[model samples]
Target: MTRRPNPFNQQAMEEVLRDLGCPESLIPSTISNYRLFVPLLFTELGEERVYQLVSRTRDELTLGEQEEAWRSSIKYIVAWAETVMEQYKHKRSNAPKSDSPDDKQPRLL
Candidate 1:
C-alpha cells in the first residue's frame, strides 16, 4: 500500500510558528511539543474533537480579561492547529479511492 502524506511536518510547523511571530528561541521547544502532542491528541480523540476542544478553549479565553501575551499565544496556537487540520482534511479527501467492485470484497488468503 502507498503511504499517505503527513500533514503535520517539521518544516510546516516551523513555518507556522514563524508566521505567528513566535520567538526564534522558542521555536524548537514549541515544535517539539507540537510534534509530540498533535498526533497523539488526534489519534486519541480524532481531529474534529481536538479542533472543537481547542476552539472552545480559545473562545473561553477571549471572553475573559486575560493577559495579552497569554491570550495571543493561545490564539496563535489555535490558528496553527486549524491550519494543520484543514490540510489533513484536504489531503484525506483527495486520496486515491478504489472504484473496482472486487476491491471491496474480503480476501480469501
Candidate 2:
C-alpha cells in the first residue's frame, strides 16, 4: 500500500526551516529528504527532545560546535527513520492473509 503525505507536517517543517534560515529554493527537497521524517522522530523521541535537537541548529554557539550538533541530530533522525521503515515493512510482510472469499468482497443482501 502506498502511504499518503502529510501536508500539515510538511508546511510546519517548511516554516521551521525558514525560521532556521533554509533558502527558498531548497525547501522542497529538504522537506522530502530531511523534514518529512520529523513527525516520526517526534513520535519516537517526544516533542521536547526533538525540539531541543532542532534548537541546536539555531544556537549562537561556536560555528563548529553548532555544525556538529546539527549533523549529529540529523544523523540520529535518519537512522531512526530507516529502522522504523524497515520494521514497518517487516510487520506488513508478516501480516495474516485473508482466508475467506467474503473477506475480499462485501456481501449484498
Candidate 3:
C-alpha cells in the first residue's frame, strides 16, 4: 500500500527547489520523477531496493554515460515543464485580467 507523501518532506523539497532556483514550471515533473524514484513515498519499493537500483544504475555507467543519462532525463523533464508553463500562460491569458506579466516582475523589498 503506497503511503501519501509526507507533507513535511514535500515542504523541504519545495525549499530545496527554491534554493536551487528551479522555476515553478519544473515543479510537477520534478515531483513526478522524485515520486517515481523515491521508495519512502511509494510502498511498491523498499529502501534496500531503491538503494540497489541507484547503485546498479550508477555502477553500470561510465562517467560520460552517467552524464548523458542525466542530460537525457533533464531534457525530458524540462520539456514537460515547458509544456506546463505554456499551458499555464495560455490559461492566465484567458483568465480575468487581474495581474499582468508587468505585475509579475520581481518586487524589490
Q: Per-prediction TM-score, please? A: 0.34, 0.35, 0.34
lDDT of 2 at 98: 87
Clash pairs (backbone) in predicted model 1:
none
Worst ten-residue run, lDDT, model 3? 38-47
Give lDDT for model 2: 0.65
Give the whole-model CA lDDT for all candidates, comma-separated: 0.65, 0.65, 0.57
Residue 25 in model 3: lDDT: 73
Model 3 Cα lDDT, one tens digit per residue, 11-102: 78877887899888777677765754433232344334444454567655422245456555545554554555566568869977656687
lDDT of 2 by residue, 53-78 (tens): 66675555323445466657766656
Selected candidate, larger lDDT, 1 vs 3: 1
User: Which 10-residue window of candidate 2 scores lowest in summed lDDT?
Assistant: 58-67
Q: Candidate 3: where is the Cα deviation over 4 Å? A: 1-8, 13-65, 98-109
lDDT of 3 at 106: 51
